[model samples]
Target: MKDYTIHRGVDYRVYESEPTTFYAKCTQYGAGCDWLIRVTKMSRKFCWEIRKYNGSHTCTRATISQDHSKLDSNTVAEAIKPLVEVDPSIRVKSVIAKVQAKFNYTISYRKAWLAKQKAVESIFSGDDLVPNIRVLHRVFWSYYPCIRAFRHCKPIVQVDGTHLYGKYKGCLLVAVSQDGNNNIVLIAFAIVEGETSEAWHFFLSNLRQHVVTRDGVGLISDRHDSIRAAIARSNGAWSPPRAFHMFCIRHIESNFLRKFKAPYLQKLIVNIGYSRTVREYETRYQRLRERVEANTNWLDRILREQYALAFDGGYRWGYMTTNLVECINSVLKGARNLPVTALVKATFYRLNELFTRKRAEAEARINAGHVFSELVTSKLHANQRAAGNIQVSCFD
Candidate 1:
C-alpha cells in the first residue's frame, strides 16, 4: 500500500475490508479527487487482483505526507469519541495507548488531550453563547426552535442545578418542562460559577426572555435561598398572575430527614406537601408538628405557598418532586466530567437523538390510529375497568 501511493503523491485510508480484500480511497477525497482502487487476493493464490480503479486525480497532486505517519486531531477525536462518550473519566494516557495499538504509532499526551478538546469544540461550536469576560462564566442555551416548543408543553417548568466535575469548577443550571404525555422537555441550560443569587438571576433572566414566554407558568424548585431571592427580584415576571414558584417536596423531606433524623416524619411531611385540600394539609401539618416541634419550626421558616400543594391551587399537577429535572441530570451525569465545549456538545447530540426517536415513535403511534400516548391510554383503561364495578341508582 505504501509503495503504490508513494509515487502518486496521495494517501489512502482503509475504506472497506474483508478476509482477503481491501478497498481504499484518496485522502483528498472531497477536494475534487476521484482516485480510488480495490484489491482482492484469492486464498489459494499468493497474488492480488486489482478489482477496480479510478485512474489519476483531477485535483492537485497530494503534496502532504502519504505514509500516514502523522494523525490529525480530528482523526484522533473520531477514534476516541466512543470511549469519551461512554466514560468521560477515561484517561489521556489510555487514548494514546489505543491509538498506538490501532495505528502502531504513539501520540504525545498533549496531542491526545488536544484531540479530546477538539472533539468537544466541534460539538458546541454551533451554538451562540452569552459573551463574558471570564472563561469559566460563559453561559449557553438551546436553539430558538427548542425554545418555541415550550408553548405546546405544560404551563409548568422546573429549574434545578447540579455540580460540574471536570477541570472547570461550575454548576449546571437547567430549565425543563413536561409535555402533555408527561415526557421531560428540556428548555435551556447554563454553566455558572455556582448557584449564587447573581447566577440564578442571570440564568432566570435569560430563560424568561428566550424560553418561558407563556404566562401563568408554574416553576418548581428546591427552597434554595438564592433561588428564592432571584425569583423575588424578577419584578413580577416570575410572581403571581404571571408565574408561580413552588418547592420540591422531596428536597424538603430530605432536609427534614437530615435535621430531625426521624424516619417516620418523612411520610407525614410528604403527605402535607401532596395534600389536595387545605383541610387535608392542615390535618397532616398538625400531625407533623405534634410529632416533632423542630419540624414545625422548619416548616415556619419556609413559605407556605411555595411548598404546600393545597395552597398552590392546582398548579403542581401532582408533581410534588423535582424528579423530572433530576432524571435529566442523571442522564447527563456521564457528560458532566468532560470539558465545557464537549459537555455542551454531549447534551446537544443527546437531545437531538431524543427528539428524533420520540418524533418517530409519535408518528408510528398516530399511523396506528392511537388517540393518546400509551401512558394516557393505560390510565383510561384502568378507569374504565374500575367504572364497571361501580353501582348506580336511579333517582325518582
Candidate 2:
C-alpha cells in the first residue's frame, strides 16, 4: 500500500477489517472515486483482492503529489541498524519487511543491502570519523580496556589464531591474558590473509612494541612453524631474559596421539606434562618411552620445557593449556562469520558487554564484604583444609 501510494501519486487508509479479511480504500473517495483493495487470509496465507476501481481518478490533481519515495539509504540504514547488530546474518528480505512495517514504505532489495553495508560502516566507523582500515591488506586491530587491564594482569599471555568465514578469506589472530579473578581478558586481535611467518611477525612485532610492554612476560601458544619462525626472527624480542615462550601441552599431546595412534599414551603424556617434580616426570616419561620406543624420537624432538609444566620453573602458573585463549575463540564463534569490519565491531561490542557485566559483579561482591573472587576464596579454603592434614617432618 505504501509503495503503491508513492508510485501512483495517491494515498490509502484502512477502511475495515474482519477476522480473515482487510479493506483499504483510496483517499480520493470524497470525489466519488471508488478505487479500493481487499485482502483475505486463508489458513494463515493472505490473498489480494482488488474490490473496486474506476481506473481513472475523478479527483483534482492539486491534492496529490507525484514525488519520489522519501525512503533513502540513510533512512533505511538507521531503521535496520538494531536488527543487523543483533544478528549479522539477517536477511535482506527481513530488512525490507521491517521498513515497510515501520515507516509504511517498501524499499528495494538492493536498497536494503546497501543500507546494511552503510549501517555496518557506520557501526565500525564512528559517526565523527571513518574507520582507519587499510584497503590493501584488509587488516584491523582493536585494544579495549585491555591496555589498562594488562598493566595489572599477570605477565602470562596466550596467542592463538583461527580462520574466518565470509566473502573474504582471512584468519583472526588473538592475544589473551587472565585478570586477577582468573577471568579471560582479551588484549589484542589482528586479521590477516593466513598464518604465515610474516603475518605472525607482524602481529607479534606490534604486540611487543605496543601491546605488551612489560619485560619477562611469558607467552604460551601452539608450536606452529610460522609462530616458531616468527619468534625466532624477533631478534630476542620474544626470547629469554625478556619474554619466555612455551608450547601448549594439549597441542603436543594431540600431535603425539595423531602420530603414534596410541590412545593409551594420552593419559601418560598428560601426567608427565602436569608433573610438579622432575622425578615424577622422569618416571612417567620412561614408561612412555619403553612402551613406544619407535616414536620416542618424535617426543624427544620438541623441547620438554616448553610443554612440561614441571620443567617450566613455575612460569606457567599451573596453566599448561591454551584453553583461556580458546575460550575467547568460542565467544567469537558467531562474529567469525561476519565481514572484517563487522567482526571487529562485534568484538568491540562483546568486550564492552563483558567488561560492564564483570565490573558490576565485582562491585556487588565487594559490597558484600568479599575479599577475593569466589573461585579464589574456594581454593583458599580447600588448600587450608588440605594443609591441616599434612604431616610435617622436622628431622631430615
Candidate 3:
C-alpha cells in the first residue's frame, strides 16, 4: 500500500497489482469520505479510478493519470515565433513563385503580378474590415495637383459612366477639367454597382460634397437620359453653380446622324462641327435641317432642338467642339477591369506617369527656348507643308 492525498487533506491508501491497477481506501478530511478508488493500467503506467462505495461492494469509477502530457502554450508560442519573424516580402515572393509554377501555361507575368497583389490584399481583408471606396477616391485625387489647384475654378464638369469588370464589376464616373492650358486633368472618380439614375444621382451628390468650386461652374456631359435625370434631381443644391450646361457636340452629332442615316446629311453635320462662326453653323444647320424635314418631320424637330441647344454661344468652349471626356475615357481604358481600390491606384499611377512625361516634355521645350504649344503647332505646320496642295485649317 502506498499512501497519498486524493483531495484537500484527505489521505488514501493505494494498492498496486500485476495488471497495473491501484486500489485505495478514502479517509475523511472534513466531509466524510464514502468513496473507494481503483487504479488501472494497460500499456505503460498505472492509473487511478474513483468510485462511490455502495455497501453492495460494486465499484463506480473515474480515471486520472499522473504521467499525461501535452504541448504547453509557451512551447506553441516559441515554435511559431520563427514563422512570424520571417520577412513578409520573402514569403510573398515564395507564394508568388508557387502560383506562377501552377498556372504557368495559362496566365501572363503581368496578370500574375496583379494576382499576387490581390492575394496580399486578401490577407488584410475580412468581414469586419472591407476596403473603403472613399479612401480609394482620395488616393486617386491626391495624384493630380492640377485638380486641387483648379478646385475653385468654375470648371465645366463632364461625367460619363462606363462598365468595369473585376472582383466587383461596376461602372465608373470620372470628373475631369479642361484647364487654362487646354490640358485635360482628372478631378475625381467613383465606382457604382450600376448605371442607374439613382446611382448617378448619388455619385453626383458625393461629387457635389467633395469638389469645392466657386459659383457659376459649368457641366458638360453626354445626353444620356439617366444623366439628365440626375442633373435635374440635383437642381437645387448640386446644380452647376453657373448658368451654363454644355452637351458633347460629338454625342449630339451622332444622335442627329442616327435619325437621318443620310451620308450627305452626315457630311453636312460634320461641316457644322468644323464651322468657325455661328453664321457658318446656321448656314450648315439650315441645309441639313431642310433635308431632314423633307425626310422625317419629327426627326427634323428633334435635330433642330438639339443642335440649337448644343451650338448656343454660351455652351461652346472656344473651339467648335469639346470632346475632352473622350480623352479621359481613353486614359481609363486599361484600368476599368480592376477592383475599386486597384482602379484608383492604377488611375493615379497612370495619371502621374502621363503628367510626368508631359512635364519632361515641357521642360525640354523650355530648355530649347520653345513653348510646348509652339512645338506642336510647328510640327503640324511642317506635316502640312509636306502634304502640299492640301488646305489645313486650325479649328481653335
Candidate 4:
C-alpha cells in the first residue's frame, strides 16, 4: 500500500497499474534491495491477491528528508477531510501539527494550505454544501453591495440568530429581506459570543450605522429579552420615525407553547396575531380571553401594534414571522462547524454569490424594459381585471 510505503520511508517504482492488477518494485531493486509486490484479481473472489512480494527492503530509503514523495497534496487532502469538514477554517499551522502528529512527518505550510483548499473545494462545491437548518448570531455586517441592494428590496427586514457548533462556540446573527419576486435577500450578518444585550447592541449598532441606515424600515425578530434591551438602549435608532421593531409571530407561538404547554390554545394565540382588521382581532382576542384569563396577561404586555397585524398599520406588510431571515439560517446548516475565519469566509462567499447572481438577473430584466417584477406585474393585471368587473357608484 502507498500508506505502507510512505510510513516505511521507502521508494517504489511502479511496473504496472490496472483496474484489477498492480505491481511495483523498490527503487533499489536491481542495486541491492529486492523489495517488490505484485497483486492480481482473483477470478472467483473478485478481490486482489498478492501473487508475489519480496520479504522486505534490504537497503536504506532513497533519501533522508523531512518531506516524502509519496505524501503529496492529494493524500494529505484525503487525510484531512475529516478535520476540514469539522472546521474548514482550521489554521494551516494546525494542519501541519495534525499531519505531524498523525504521520510523524513535518509538512510544509504551503502544502498544508493547499490540502485545506482542496478539502474545502471538495466539501463546499456543487451539491455538497451544509444541508440542514442551523443558525448563529455573534456580530452584524453587510457587504457594501448587499447594503446597496437592500435599498431596492421591500421596506421590511427580518433578523434571527442560532447556535454555532465545533471547536469555537458562539452565535450567528443575520438580517434578511425579500424582493418583489419573493427572493430571500441576506442583508447583514455577524457572529457574537451569545444572545446577550451587549452582543446585540454591538450587532444592531453596526447594522444600523452601516447597512440599515434608512428611516421607517420594519425590523422583525423574535421577542428575545436581549433584543428588547438593545432596542430600548438604541435611543430611537430602532424606535418610531427611525425604525419600527416587530416581533415574529412564530416566536410568539413558540413562547406561548413553551409557557402554558397548551397545544390546543396555540391556534387562538396565532389567530390573535394574524387578525387583519380591528374587528377580526377583537373577535380573536375575545375568543382567547374566554379560555385563557391568567395566561393572557403576557400577551397584553407586548403592544398589539408590535405583533398583531390589525394594529401594525402597514408596517408588517403581511409578514407574520421571521421566516425570511430564518431561511438564511437554514442555508447555514454546515457553516457552523467551521472556525471563525473559515466560517466568515464561507458565509460571505455564498451570500455574495447569491447577491451577485440576483443582481444580474434584475439588471437583465430592467434592460429588457420591465418596471415591475413578474409577481407585481401579474398582480397589477389581475387587479385591473377585477376593477373592470366592478360597478362604481357616483359619490354625492
The list of candidate 2 runs beyond 4 A from truth reads: 1-79, 86-134, 138-140, 366-396
In model 1, which residue pairs have backbone atoms overlapping below 3 Å?
Answer: none
Q: lDDT tens string, model 2, 269-325? A: 878888889999889888888886866678788887788877886778788999999
**Candidate 1 Cα deviation (angstroms), residue 170:** 0.6
TM-score per model over all chains: 0.64, 0.67, 0.53, 0.64
Residue 178's lDDT within candidate 1 is 89
Query: Each model's C-alpha lDDT?
Result: 0.80, 0.80, 0.54, 0.83
Model 3 residue pairs with clashes: 21-39, 22-39, 216-241, 216-242, 217-242
Looking at model 3, report the run of 10 residues with the lowest lDDT sum. 66-75
Judged by lDDT, which candidate is best? Answer: 4
For residues 320-359, could you state the per-residue lDDT of candidate 1 as single tens digits?
8888999899888867877777777677877788788988
Tell me the deviation in Å of residue 158 in model 1: 0.8
Residues 1-396 of candidate 4 have per-residue lDDT tens digits of 878878888879899999889999998988999999999999899778999988878889656889777788888998998888666657789889988888788998899978887777776653444678355544456787778878988889888888888657889888888888888878888889999999989988988999888988999999999999999999999999888899988889999899889999888888889998999998888787788786678798889999999989788889999888777787887677666656777776787677678779879978666545666899999998877667343221
Q: Which parts of model 4 are misplaced by more than 4 Å?
A: 1-33, 36-74, 78-140, 363-396
Q: Which digits, one per residue and each the tens of the lDDT, describe model 3 over residues 230-294?
A: 87787755453443555665676677667656655655665665666678867776776676566
Better of 2 and 4 by TM-score: 2
As for model 3, its CA RMSD to the true structure in angstroms is 19.8
RMSD (Å) of each candidate, 1 decimal: 13.8, 13.7, 19.8, 14.8
